[model samples]
Target: MSGGDGQPRDGSGADQPQPGRSEAEESRRGAAYGFTAYAVWGLFPLYFAALKPAGAWEILSHRILWTLLLCLVVLGLRRDLVWLRDLARRPRLAGGVTAAALLIGVNWVVYVAAVLNDHTTEAALGYFLNPIVTVALGVLVLRERLRPLQWVAVAIGALAGVYLSVAAGSVPVIALTLAFSFGGYGLVKKKVGVSLTAMQSLSAETLVLGPIAVVMLAVLTVRGDTTFTTDGAWHMTLLVLAGVATATPLLLFAAAARRVPLVTIGLLQFITPVLQLLCGVLLLHEHMSTARWTGFAIVWLALVVLTVDTLRHRTGLARARAAELADITP
Candidate 1:
């Protein structure tokens, strides 16, 4: 039967559309996908560490080339080339995709270098700062208004950054670079919207950078510095599998972004840094000084404030939505 509001109702007259319930379910699913993506990303140190005997540059080239090849194969199999036609017609979006490709390229190279150089802890710190950077970008670039608690969180994060820089007697360049590059990439992705599927987006990004990767690999081969052939079959296999490793979490992340709010995505991102921190301290046996620990503690405090505010805000919105629904239902 149909209710007065034109919505379908069950025997008890409860509305069947259940917008609130469906939205909550989608949010929950997005959170799950985001968590899984970050968890995989957190374990990246181990994977990169295993790709040794290959320098950062060589590894990056292989990663780009292989990932591009993989994306193309998948797209071809799916017979999903129509998006390319659409993308070609939209110069603005194409430009955004190019910018995203460059930003991610920087992030990937820096990350690979950090792992190879035993800077995993610093890389973890970068991710820990990512949410703060993301929020700052929203304020500065998107011109979004922030609540008081958000302002407080941003202030605390800045303090933490300053303290870390002073204690180290230098700016945390790797951390800052990773945080900003990824933050910018995220912002561009958000602006681009989710009209494209995850696979399509990946394919577009890789295609943009595909030429550079190809040239780099060719140069490395001519110089006889390439490891794909010099390394044993096991090493070669690991390098090839890099395509799958790179694409999987990114695809999940894109899916999560499509389904969830940016705040929810930010909250879930803590998982990646926490896991990376553990990997650094326990697995890689990286040194963590008292000063570094203190800085991280301050960052944690900021994150706590941000997370609490987000939860409360979400709860308030949910309750208001429920009340509005109740008022409309007769």
Candidate 2:
């Protein structure tokens, strides 16, 4: 039943484990998970657009409230409230999560506002710019080293801004806001470390924001300005679905992060903005100027360089590891 490689094989020897098959399978599954997350994120313009009766503020509040409820339910099912207790014992970690919560909360608000205001193209541009922002954050805040190509990639990303300004008529404030806010959130989460699981960290973040969200919702309800009570079933449904939309992609992203190596994850990150840009132009019927396209082209090339550089570095490391093992074997 087993071959020399320990793979289950038939008499024909046709089913033996191929070299690097496990790694390939893992990469495939990770890409699938990453695609699921980014795809959901790409389609967010439609989701936010559908919530027209509700303002961004109300929608964001409900998202926080419902996401908290969902996280609590997950915790109950998993029977893991230990992380919450641990957070209470550790103020520094709690503080980090709190900062991350605030940052992501602002990101949500800005993103929702952008979508509702017909700035989906700009929003997509923001996401397109995010990876380099993340890399820059890593270098500046985390003290991570970058290769020569990576540095060139960052510089190319920077030049895209000038191109956009010249060709796109003006600077994209919404795009920059989204890029920096999410970048800062990523930095904070990185600082928070792996002590808390994704679910637990998200729960902790929501815990920090939930009270404010509740108060805001309560105020809107009292003033009879909230769409939740006034809007019909369709609007209400979408509002509730907002939490699922937000949480599901995040959970998928976390799962993908665990399964995929960092380089693959970086490659997968581009899928989101590409989808968003398509949604913006094709689905949402937004316009794109030639200059804007040129700028986008530059950033796209930079991402290609960065990804290739990452893959090359990882391949080199893998070869080095294999050589080390071979040396030890003799």
Per-residue lDDT of 138-215 in model 1, one digit per residue for the tens? 999999999888899999999999999999999999889988888888788788765566667767888888898889
In TM-score terms, which candidate is top?
A: 2
Would you estimate the TM-scores of all the predictions? 0.88, 0.89
RMSD of every prediction: 8.7, 8.7
Instruction: Report the C-alpha displacement of residue 163, candidate 2, in angstroms.
Output: 2.1
List where candidate 1 sits over 4 angstroms from the true fold: 1-33, 254-265
TM-score of model number 2 = 0.89
> Which candidate wins on lDDT?
1
Angstrom error of the Cα, residue 297, model 2: value is 1.1
Task: Name the lDDT value of residue 238 in candidate 1.
Answer: 96
For model 2, residues 229-259, the per-residue Cα lDDT tens digits are 6789988888887767766777666656655
